[model samples]
Target: MSGRFAPYGWSLVLHAVVVALLGVSLHAPAPRPQPAAAQAEAEPIQARAVDEAQVQAEVQRLRDEARRQQQQEEARRQQLRDEAQRAREVRQREEQRAAEVKRRAEEEQRQRAAAEQERKAKEAAEQKRLADLQKAAEEAEKKRIAEEKKARELEARRKQEEEARKKAAAEADLKAKMAEAQRQMEAEAQKRAQERARQNATLVQQYIADIRNKVERNWLRPATARPGMTCTVLVQQLPTGDVVNVRITRGSGDAVFDRSVEIAVHKATPLPPPPVPELWEREIEFIFEAR
Candidate 1:
């Protein structure tokens, strides 16, 4: 009744008042005889007067209720507007806070990005430094290896030179010893040759005599041969005392005697060896005489 229901109450009251007037009008008697009609009209006028006063009271109550309801509606509308304003202020504050948070987050992200970039740069520099160090170490290792190789080569060459010097010295000493031995051998050989010549002086004559006797035994006298026939024969022999060749250096006057003498020498195929190897000769000469 204080708000939306006030108008409804006013309408109900007005309707009730109309219904009472209608009933009164409907129940009133028809126009009566003059004296009775006047009395009935007077009673209806008094009843209408009472109904009009009630109607005025109801109208006043309706007016007062409408005013109260209007005031309450105005207050409700004012409260709604205040709540809406508060909501707007709160929304604005939230927007401001959100903007500030976003700005801070963007700043932090930028700082983190800068730090990450710096870290990557430092890592790259460190890697390059390590690579340089490794390269230097490799170069040092190569230098050390080269130095060791050079030292080894020098040592090997020194050993080879030492060995060569020793070999040359040994060869020189051997040559000197061989020269001394050769001189001694030559001296001994000359001494032995003189001794052999002295010893073979008589043996050589006997060897010739033995060869003449052998030829005489093998000879066949020719019919034309004569006493006093004398010839010097040259004979060639081998180391085994085998006759290799024969010739008459001096011949007898008769051809038959000369041929017979040459045949006799040939018939003595193998003669005799010398008593000493030094006395052996490849050639021998002898005189043949027919007595």
Candidate 2:
């Protein structure tokens, strides 16, 4: 088994095999004595001792080599198994790392999708809220406009009614004033007419007195006249107070007295003119008495 003794051990096994071969050849049967003078010379006989211990040592060396080769083969197989196990562990680690990467990627994708959905939902809600607000504003505006229009119409109607009432009051006031004016004018006219009539009557009396005084001044007393005699005489006159006719409407019993009254009336001619034009008449009558 020691490297230093291996060559000596191989040399000893070779020598043993040569000694066995020589022994067989030397111990073979002698041939018949060759005829004298034709026989070859015989070599010297060499004797070698076979050592059992050296043979045993050689066999042990062969066994040791075989054992060493078997140990080498088993070592190689163990190394191959270790290398395969290491490869399998490396492949498993790589696969685990790849699976982790894929899981992370998938999770990121899911999160992004969720975020996008949330954003879209919020945007839609905002749009709907804006639309609702706009619709409410429009309705409120319409209501305000309608109320304003109604208020304006009511105000216009009220103003028109007020104007109509004022107009009616004015017309009533005007009618009352006109009726009062008419009454005052009629009363004034009646008062003026009565004053004129009174003045005309006074003037008529004065004229009648003048006529009687003139007739008496012109009378000549009849000697046959009796005291307390009276006569009614009718006289007719013109606008110039000139007598046109005279007659006795009632005579005294004394014909001479009545005749004298008629004569006096005629002598009175051109009787006094009336003070007013309207008082002049075509006929006049007076009473005469003897004083």
Candidate 3:
């Protein structure tokens, strides 16, 4: 029992000492030994026993109060630890959220940069295509102009050649007409000359016949004249066809017959006139005969 209470032995001893001092102060004076002295002494001893029991009970109550206070301090320390752990967890979650936001912002910036570059490239390609089309159109226009110029030149040359050919043909036709006209004029002159000659011949024959008939009608047949007697006579006449002279070119051997033929030609005066003036002869000879 002493070993079990050894941990609180000093506290129990101090309590017992305090209780003994209080009992001494509260005790009455001892009575003188007499017939009632034993009873008084016995009461003092019981009172001392009661006081010791009360001291023991008070020490036990003090020890129970100290134990309760220590348990309440331990509970407060556990609650503080739990609060600190919860605060640390909240700080870590906030830092993670900040990092995620920064990463998303950086990705969006990269996408914007790529889109800008693609837009510039597309614009440059469109400009180049428009320039190529303009160049092609200019070349086509130049070619068309050159072809038109060449065609116009060809047409002009063809027209010139056609005009030259027509001029030459006209000249050839005029020359042919002039040559034919010249030939026709020469043939007409020859035909007129032949007609005049024939007309002159006929007029001369008619005049000779008229002279013979007139001389025969006027001739008086001389007795010395015979049928074989013939002579040539020449006569001259005025524009009025009157005979002016008569000569015998060849006379017959009989002089009387020649004179008779001469006298007959003179008596036949005023010979027949020619039909055309071109047929009139200033001198003429005729044969005279008595037949």
Highest lDDT: give the candidate number.
Answer: 1
Candidate 3 lDDT for residue 137 = 82
Give the runs in model 3 whose Cα sits over 4 Å from its true position.
1-190
- What is the TM-score of each predicted model, taking all chains together? 0.36, 0.39, 0.36
Best by TM-score: 2
Candidate 1: segments with Cα more than 4 A from true spot: 1-60, 143-291
What are the per-residue Cα lDDT tens digits for candidate 2 across 125-150? 88888888888889888988888888
- Kindly list the per-residue Cα lDDT of model 3 for residues 129-155, writing each as its tens digit: 887888888888888888888888888
List where candidate 2 sits over 4 angstroms from the true fold.
1-107, 169-291
Candidate 1 displacement at residue 65 in angstroms = 3.4
lDDT of 1: 0.79
- Tell me how candidate 2 scores on lDDT: 0.75
Please report the TM-score between candidate 1 and the true structure: 0.36
